[model samples]
Target: MISKIYTIIKGTGKYIPHLRVKNEDFLNNTFYDTYGKKGEKSNQEITEKFEEITTITERRHVSKDLVTSDIAFFAAEDAIISSKIDKEKLDYIIVAHNFGDVKHDNRKSDLVPSLAARVKHKLKIQNPNCIAYDLPFGCPGWLQATIQADYYIKSGDAKQILVIGADVLSRISDPHDRDSMLYADGAGAVILEGKESDTPIGILAHTTRSDTYQFSEMLYMDTSFNPDSEHKDALFLKMNGRKLYQYALTTVPQAIQACLEKSKTPLSEIKKVLIHQANGKMDDAILKRLYALYDIKELPKDIMPMTISWLGNSSVATVPTLLDLILKDELKPHKINAGDSIVFASVGAGMNINAMVYKM
Candidate 1:
């Protein structure tokens, strides 16, 4: 049986510090300068390459003193405020992140309880039922948390739920790798309020699939802490870009189709497609293929492809940050009506693909 509809009461976002690092800045400060000095390339050539490979023009980064939880706190506070639902009414807080406090062995799940306790205390909520927990699922974590909250609200277990996605990519990337150029840091959130209605503005249908066989495509571990190794940079994100791209191309479209089928919605009914924004070229290619498969002329103008070029990719925060940008007018004007559909799809490091269809 299908669950009843739930409304998104509010949404809030907090980006990492607004330090603008331009392409030229990278060329001048990094090893790329050596190539220029040898007369093999010019500054303009380096800048063009940076722009071509990354969608981020600028991205946020946490200061050395800050951590992932700090960013999560900021985003959660904004979501609580925007919901206009008193913090006292918040019964649950679920945070989604790929990385968290370094010292915590349990990561988000165990780390959030104390933080939630402090927040509840500061808000002066008399109820002791408020609970907090963490979920770590890479880039698709936010969507997963949203669906979980929706179920909680539908089950009449909570009134207001706060879902936050936060990550500090700068600290997780391999400093010497060229791929590290594609990472950044940021946080975003949404507040869900339970409601029963035929009107569909929140989540409609969601589907998730994972190929564990491809798990090695992306992996991270604390190798730096190994007693046998003297290298302090042992812990970092490792990804095979070529393999990841191939997986995304093969799996994401199928996921979207499955979501639409489950929702009983047709491709023609969709007004906009909000993908993971992982890469500009990949997104363009996917949309083109979709257009051909559906034989549709003139794709919707509301598609948003904004990503932090200099900041790299913030994984789970990407979708929410893009949504935040949309709400803030980064997405162009369009005709999104009550019955129109919007498809959100993500292909992340776990070799996982998630797609959801929403009626706007």
Candidate 2:
């Protein structure tokens, strides 16, 4: 039999902006006044109810002077340091994001200099042989990049790859949109290294699907159109909360199950699942459905660790950042030990849903 090559998570790192935004910050907000329930209740009361539903008390946003690439650089640096690999040895750098560097004034995506190339420049990788690219797979972008890296390793085409997921939704968000409160800014990265191992450690199997024909506009922004068009209101992120929630509940669980089946790993063997921190309630519901698929009635408390309560939704950065925190023991009461089986799942724009089964 041919020698099996596996991609292992060598290290992880994250960059969270220093700025913290509390729910109360939006008190008397124009967004809530117009679209939210501020008309019927006080802002404070509305904030409380908002917190109750999403469990989001606060989130982070980059400073006015920072851009998406700047934050991504910090995260990439940390991942490189933790991996202890020479900078020149990095064979690939994949960045997953929606909007590139957003001009704070205009709120436009600046993608001329691809975000991956910017990250490579920031990392000071002088080797022209090192290839860098971007993957815009919605919130599941990071996981998707990891899956791709796994393929490269298995194909013997790459040795070490840095996959970074980041986004500055705060820049693209409309202050008048209630969804603004649901978005944040952050970056997370991981170093995937190829290693020869007999045991099945690394990405074992994955599944992904996109239903954009029907739900293409379910969670998207209004940009990427002709500037001269009459769609002047196409600048901010728009989402159908209920429809997206229903989509996640229906699709995410099935994707995870399919991945598990492909991996031939039992649900009971999964130690923890690093799911996208989209919405606290919706994520919980997705996990409940996942457990139900295996006929497990009661959901495991710590099986699904979440940081969205404080981190909000940082688009693609949620999973990797949460994974980094948990791996570092910074997120207490949740830990991943050696030989543990883990699942990573996410659902987002493109109406895309994906999941991967990994062995540690």
Candidate 3:
């Protein structure tokens, strides 16, 4: 019989830069001066604007002194140390990033090798068989990497894997764009070890689906900064908010249901639902629909929504980052017990939807 693969989440860590940009600070310092006419707008005017639309209280940005890889390295080091696992035993490092040190090169292939080398040197692991690579799938990249790593470890190709998700959105965000307000910079890391156990806290089942027909609803590119040109905003993240919301509301539930079904677990048995920290409204909508459909009342009151009023979205790092936050709290009374389940879901650009069930 094939040895059943078990991936235990040994450790989790996250890093955010020192610099903090509050909503009021952003409006008073930049928004009004840049967008206001004639003269700078008063503080009251700025406050009014923020209150009109959903107000984002604060967000963290990578300091000018640090780069994307620096954040990733910090998180990775913390995770490795926290897990108390032998560094020499780690045989793989997988990075899920949408943006990375783009100033040096545009292609992801070029940057990943440099990052891997830096990580290997810092960790001081001299295993010649160690391998490192990158996976790009926007917000769902981390889940994809987890499944891939599990496959590698199960095949005896690797003993341990360090999965890192990092993104620096401020670098690509168009300063003049309001949509840019939704993004922040951060990194998260998780150490997974190959082990045989009846109970596993790692991935139990994961599924992904893509609808290419709606690909153009959200996108990013690099173009000139000409103010007069119609394509001036092409370089920054753009999304048809209404359409994207519709897609998310419809797909995420189905994905979660599929994951639970495949794992042979009932939705009501899940202890917590760790959905992507995308938006407060989107999350609420998804849960409401779930409650109505499944008639399950075990949903915990401690809903984790780290993205809503703070970290807009960090692309691939969202899920891992949230996981780090939960673990740092010691899991508290909200701890995920053995045999209990948690649902991880994300719906992002490319109209992609993914969900995974974890049996703790």
Q: Specify the highest-lDDT model's number.
A: 2
Between candidates 1 and 2, the TM-score winner: 2
Task: Return the lDDT, model 2, position 25.
Answer: 95
Q: Estimate candidate 3's RMSD in Å.
A: 4.3
Which 10-residue window of candidate 2 scores lowest in summed lDDT? Answer: 222-231
lDDT of 2 by residue, 113-229 (tens): 899999999888899989999999888899889888988888989999999999999988766556778999999999999988767778889898989899888886654223333
TM-score, one value per model: 0.82, 0.94, 0.84
In model 3, what lDDT does residue 334 have?
A: 50
User: What tens-digit string does per-residue lDDT give for candidate 3 at 208-286?
Assistant: 9988775645664644233443444346555566677777777788788888889887866777787766666677788
Ranking under lDDT, best-scoring first? Answer: 2, 3, 1
Off by over 4 Å in 1: 1-9, 28-47, 102-126, 199-201, 219-233, 309-311, 330-340
Model 3 alpha-carbon miss at residue 138, Å: 0.3
Q: Could you give candidate 1's per-residue lDDT for residues 1-360 as a string of tens digits? A: 454647554655656556554555555523212122233456466557756865555556676665677777777776666566777677788877876653322222235444444444545668677787777777888888887887788778987888877887776654434455667777887777877775565677889998878464554543322233334535757666767777777777778888888888888778778777677777777776667667766776655455655445778887776766665565456333455578878778677778888765
Report every candidate's CA lDDT. 0.67, 0.87, 0.71
Worst 10 residues of 3 by lDDT: 30-39
